[model samples]
Structure formats: structure tokens, C-alpha cells
Target: MPRTEPRVRRLAAGLPAVAAAAVYGWAHWCLAGPASPPTAVAWLGAVLLLVGACVAYGVLVGGSGSVFGGLLLALALLLTVTAADQTASRPATASCVVREVHTRLQGSLGEGAPSQKTVYRLTLDCPGGYPGELKDDRAVAAVGEEVKVAYDPRRRASPAPEAETSPWRAALCAVLLLAASTVIAGRRPGPATRPRPGFTPG
Candidate 1:
């Protein structure tokens, strides 16, 4: 066997998946052009697709923490698509006041800070608006602070905060997540994963 580094091969494999994600994002824009309803199916599909990618990556990695990166990658992908989808379809914008903030562990983090960040629930006050749950990294948004929220015109109850995401950030994270997925896909299956003889995966 030509000892090919799994990392490299995984990355190579991830390129297409990343591109697919991009295509889906763009298609979302096209389909939703000129105003379109937020399809629950689309949201569910996006969630499943991203989650599937992460699971695939996790399986590829195969280790004690079998699905480490996969879960985060899944979330990152889901949120990215959701955010892009909203932005593409003329997401309804409204201002809201932060009701409260709570910390949640995500994944890796930068230097001198927690790996997780705080999530803020805001009370949206706008025509045809309802309270919503939103989150942003610690770098932005303080508890009890007023901020602008973007959400589906049809369902104002589910809001995505502007501070939670931006174009550049989304693009950057997409690429990073793809790369991480690849890296994770390259690991060997740990002792934790082993099918005994005549035993099924289940």
C-alpha cells in the first residue's frame, strides 16, 4: 500500500462536499429569490445534510472520541446554511433587547478564552415579531444588550441575530469546518471501535 496520509486524502475528499455545501447555499438563494416561504423541509434537510457530513467524517476518523469533530462540524454547517438561507430570502429584520445570556460549550476556542461562548435570548419587538433565541461568540454581544435580529418573515419567533454571523465569518468557518472534517476523517479507529467476529455493527 502506498502509505498515503489519511489527512491529505480526507481533505481531498472533503473538497467536493464543501463545494456541494456552497452550491446548496447558492441554490437556496436562487430558489428563494423574489421572496419565498421558509420551507421546514429545507431547514430539516440542511440540518440532516450537515449532520450526515459530520457523521461521515467522524466515522472516517474512528477513535475513542469517535464523533468529536463531527458534531461541531454538523452544527457549524447547520448554522451556516440556516444563516445564509435567511440572508438570501430577505430575512425579516427587527431590534430586540437581550433577556438573558448563558454559556454553552461548542468546540475548540482561541487563546485566553473559553472554548464555549454565551447564548443570548432576545425579546424581539417589531411588527409581526416574537421573542427569539440567538447567540454570538464572546467577542461580540453582551448580556442585556439591545441588538438587531434577522428571522423568517413568516416565523418571526425563530430569530437569528446579526451579531451571531456575517458573510466573511460564515465563509471562513465553512472552509475551516471542511478542513477540520477532513483532518478528523484521517484518524484511525480507536480501540473503542471494533466489531467482534460474527458481530454486527449495531
Candidate 2:
């Protein structure tokens, strides 16, 4: 019995890692496919599955460090899946008229007087029922000008002239979070000590 206990514990500890990997693989397969854009229902289902896996791992591991690490792992998986989805899917295009244009200065107003970049927000009206606003650093269109905007009808998010989706930044963050989770989950709890015979409560 004593020899079997250690093996059981080792197997339990490995379960979460396996589960996390499985969830990541499933998400990539579902979201990063070259088929039609995934529906809102598909997205919701994937998110729920990912959350359930993380929660199950946390509960099974039964440690503060493990729980926290599971959370970090969940976040990393979410980012990675989202980046993959955005990178793989193709967006629909529509011609929109720029209704209004607003500009704002972004960056630090510091002691050294660093240069601030201008951010442009454009309100657009599209014939394809795409009524949304877009914000970007470049001034791509002027008021009353017609410009082409790319959008995902499934997401119904604000359309933009260009889809600036890249997986590198999100992938980088995911890698860092995954590393932290591995380090934390691998940590063993400190040894417990009993009070000495002469020790008394303070």
C-alpha cells in the first residue's frame, strides 16, 4: 500500500499537465481551421471547455500553488487560441463611408518631453449593415470618404480597414505564462514541523 501511494500521487500530479495539453490541442484544431468562421456558439463552447479543464485540474491538484498555476495556464491557453483563430480566419470586406473622425494623443507626457503618437478613431457606415467605429494609429480615411473595411460577421466586432491580427505578441505572452505555471506547479510544499515537548502556546 505504501509503495502504491507514491505512484498514485505522481500519476495525479501528471493528470493536470496532460489535460492542459489536450485542451490546447483541441482549441487549436477547432479554432485554427481553414473552414468558415466559427460561430458564437462554437466560441462559447470552447471557452467553457477550457474553463472546466482548468477548474478540474485545480481541484484535483489540491494546492494553492497548483490552483494559481492552473489559472495562469488557462489564461495562456485562451490567448494562444484567440491568436490562432484570428490569424487563421478570413474576414469579409465592405465599403464604408467615414462619418466622423476623432484624434487623440497617445503615449507619455513625461519630463523629457517624449513624442506622442496620434491615434485616429473613425465612425463608419457601411451598406452591408456594418455600423461601427474603428481606431488605429494611421489616418487612413477622411470624413465622407469611402474606404474598404474588413470584418468578421460572426464576431460582429468593429470593422477596420485592415485586419491587424498577429499571433506573435499573444503567443509570446502565452509562452511566458506557461513557463511560470510549470515552475509554480512543480514546486513542492515545505515540510511540516511539530512543536517541541517544552514549547508552550504564546
Candidate 3:
């Protein structure tokens, strides 16, 4: 088959996934109020889920039409959607003081592997009478510093801070996934490749 044919097939396979991402992105903008930072667990779960799905799909796509790929693809897309939703919505805003700062080092052991990176968390006194803590890749402000927080007032007892996410980043991820899915589809075994057990050339 021509190289372009495989690529086109792959892109077609990924169209549904891309459309889903777009819908979630739109819903996020409509529902989420303002942007704040998401919790550590939320961010970690989403990233890990996406990365895991990509790796799993990469391994299983060779099977061609395996349900595993579709399942993982769905999970990854769901994470992407949830991330968008969390990023877009914050019903209320308040000024809070950074009561404390905490940091932790994270990485795995290997030669020339990824180096350890520090994760920062900030404890804040959220407005509307609730205290909250938020996590981020880097500290947005220093301890004892006053900062603005965006939250959903409905959860007055334990309001979660809004995490800022770039729409472009989500778009880029969708594009990359579409490309990867296309490549995998192109690599799938064609109909002619089936073996006949008793066939032989005499």
C-alpha cells in the first residue's frame, strides 16, 4: 500500500477520539467558572492514565482490532476531558494567604534516566470561610504570601482550587494522539496476511 494510504486510514480511525476531545473542551469552557490549580492527585491521575494508555495502545495495536486499544483510548480521552472540565470551572474567587509550602522529590532509578523533579504544594486560607490547599508543579507564590484563589462555592466546607490548563496544550495532545492512532492503524495486519495451515509449494 502507498505510505499515504496507511496514514489516511489511521487518521480516520482517530476521528471519533478527536471529536470527543473537542466536545469535552467546549463543555469545560461552558461549565467551569475561572482557572485555579488542580490537586496533586487529580493531575497525577490524569497524566498517568494518558501515558499508560498510550503505552498500552502502542503495544497492543499490533494485534489489529484488539479491544484493548479502544478501551485504553477511551480511558485516556476521559482523563483529558476531566482535566479540561477542572481547568475551566471556578464559581468563586478569594484572596488567601499561603500558610505553608511543602516540596517532595520524585523520580526512578536508572542511568541517564529522568532526573528527580520537585513538586510543590501550598496551604491556603480560602475566602468564604474555608481553608484549602492546592498543589502545582511549581510554587506560584511564597509562604506567607497572599494570592488569589478561584473555587467552587458549592463545596464550602472543602473547596478545591481551580487548576489552570492551556487549551492549546489539550489541542496539541489530541493532535498527537490522532497521529499516533493513525500510525498504529497503518501498522495493522492486512486481510491478505492470514495463513492457510495446509498450503505449501511443491
- The TM-scores of all predictions, comma-separated, are 0.54, 0.57, 0.53
Per-residue error (Å), model 2, residue 193: 17
Clashes of each: 1, 0, 11
Q: Ten consecutive residues with minimal summed lDDT in candidate 3?
A: 154-163
Error of 1 at 135 (Å): 5.4
- Measured with C-alpha atoms, the lDDT of residue 164 in candidate 2 is 68
lDDT-best of 2 and 3 = 2
lDDT for model 3, please.
0.54
Tell me the lDDT of candidate 1.
Answer: 0.53
Give the winner by TM-score: 2 or 3.
2
Please provide, for model 2 over 60-165, each residue's C-alpha lDDT reduced to its tens digit, 9 standing for 90 to 100: 4446765666777777777666556546544687788899999998874432222588989998888866647777768889999988877767542335566565
Cα lDDT tens digits for candidate 3, 37-77: 35554445545555555554444344544344444355446
Query: Could you tell me the lDDT of residue 68 within candidate 2?
Result: 69
Quote the lDDT for 103 in model 3.
95
Candidate 1, clashing residue pairs? 62-189
Number of the top candidate by TM-score? 2
lDDT (Cα, 0-100) at 5 in candidate 1: 48
Name the TM-score of candidate 3.
Answer: 0.53
Predicted candidate 1 versus true structure: per-residue lDDT over 42-154, tens digit per residue: 55655566656655555555564335556546545654664565455335676776665666656544432225654433343444445455645442446566777766565
